[model samples]
Target chain A: MSTRLDFFIDRMVSQRACLDFGIAQTADMQGPVFELGLGNGRTYHHMQHNIKGRDLYVFERAVASHPDSTPPEELTILGDVRETLPAALTRFGATASLIHADLGGHNRAKNDAFAQLISPLVEPLLAVGGLMVSSDRMYFEALTEMPLPPEAVEGRCFIYRRDS
Target chain B: MSTRLDFFIDRMVSQRACLDFGIAQTADMQGPVFELGLGNGRTYHHMQHNIKGRDLYVFERAVASHPDSTPPEELTILGDVRETLPAALTRFGATASLIHADLGGHNRAKNDAFAQLISPLVEPLLAVGGLMVSSDRMYFEALTEMPLPPEAVEGRCFIYRRDS
Candidate 1:
């Protein structure tokens, strides 16, 4: 019996909780961080402040965020993710310690389609024990779903880890 | 603007998320798990299923949980937490890896007072790096507040880690 507002709150809170856990869990790992679909750059801004000793790269078609939240040009990859993500494998290899995506909108059909399309592209990017936080359930061939932290709503946010 | 139901859902989801994280984080740590208030034994049941490699002890004055949720006599300490928690220090020593407490009710003043009383008692039982998850804000001199997961609502659930 949750309203749309309740769902939104759940999504936001769950996203934060998973991100915090991912950052902490991967603190000792060596790799850059990737943020997919940095709409308004809020999540990217959060990563910018909290993540240490790791470069954060944002994948987006373009930049349109709060003045303070936008990433520097050098760190921002401006292109469709379908193109940029695969290209990243060559430049960065499968060495991302964390990859966060919130690419889907209100359309359920479109969201599912997008998740299926990107899941494979995202899976190969994570390093061993690396965490993936997503707004939609993603299809991964090898990545395992990690248990959600206690503030995360089930189905609202998803976390997957690369074991190999 | 959230309804009472929304708050309830947040509490439930946050509780589950925190417990899962605490259980996983402490999987390699030494010492047992403690359930400070086994109200209805829902959380206890959860810990029983998910927790491994450690014994789980419940502190409660009496047992009134559903039959399926009840703990065995040996693991269930049947006394008020104010008395039994201190006694636990002598029996179990300061080596609990995870302690989950939901000792407060709806009354703000009463909940605050209870949290204050139990915070000190609870603080000494944890092993270093052990996590404490609570339903109310606890005043801890040494334990640091860990960031919440994305699904958890702020102030609805709190997680603290004993770093020493």
Candidate 2:
């Protein structure tokens, strides 16, 4: 029970950080909202509702979310994010203002490895001063750690800004 | 000690809620950020750095916060918030997109009454779809409760959106 509560809190805090990034910073930056995970589509839907008028381009392996939650055709990137993200940059241009990386799994080792794998690929696409809001901390050259807001518990939500 | 911890968690959850509101909704809206309290300038500083290029207007009884953290002369509204908020809005115009109400004293009854006192004066100034991120749950007719993001412990933070 306690573990479940912790999971809920962690996701809640991290997701809030994502929203704050959009309002506080992404509002000024030009580009569509991007996400690496479309699981359940909860986060994607939340972003759409909160950031009205922003386009969301997502990379997913399959149509995992409820049909109602899926992004429209042309917005969804089918296949593994590791390969699709680079292809996406070529198509969309490196203009993502906000990127929410929600890639994590029940296995910690795998999740950690996956984050490392994609960090390099994702780095170049973020526009200057764009935000990378993630579930886990991913280090990339030129990205600076933005302080977590007061409501965020340490280690729960990781936020970084591309300063350059 | 436990009481202090609870207070911290509550504030943290609410602050996360505030950020969620901004990202999810306020980023698309127009207007400057407004604050009802300026204690220590911690929250103010957090907002400025995270939100990026947004002007912050603050109301305080006296000058407080670190010298470096203070908002500029034009942005800081001195004297009581109930008075300062209205006059400042007259100058700044009724276009505040994000309003952070942090008025909290140890006394619950006084805080409740103070919330009531300030609600009417603050409401009209919020642009439609602007956010009212407060320490307490202030019920206004036009405001709707945005679901608290996952990390937020229920009742710890209160968030309301100006739907109209």
List lDDT for all candidates, in order.
0.87, 0.74
Residue by residue across A75-155, what tens digits does model 1's lDDT show? 999999999999999999889999999998767899999999999999999999899999999999999999999988899
Off by over 4 Å in 2: B1-164
User: Which residue window of length 10 is worst by lDDT in model 2 chain B?
Assistant: B1-10
- As a TM-score, model 2 comes out at 0.49
Best by lDDT: 1
> Candidate 2 at B8: error in angstroms?
23
Model 1 has fnat of 0.00
Q: Which candidate is the best by TM-score?
A: 1
Q: How does model 1 do on interface RMSD, in angstroms?
A: 13.0
DockQ of candidates 1 onward, in order?
Answer: 0.02, 0.01
Counted clashes in each candidate structure: 15, 8
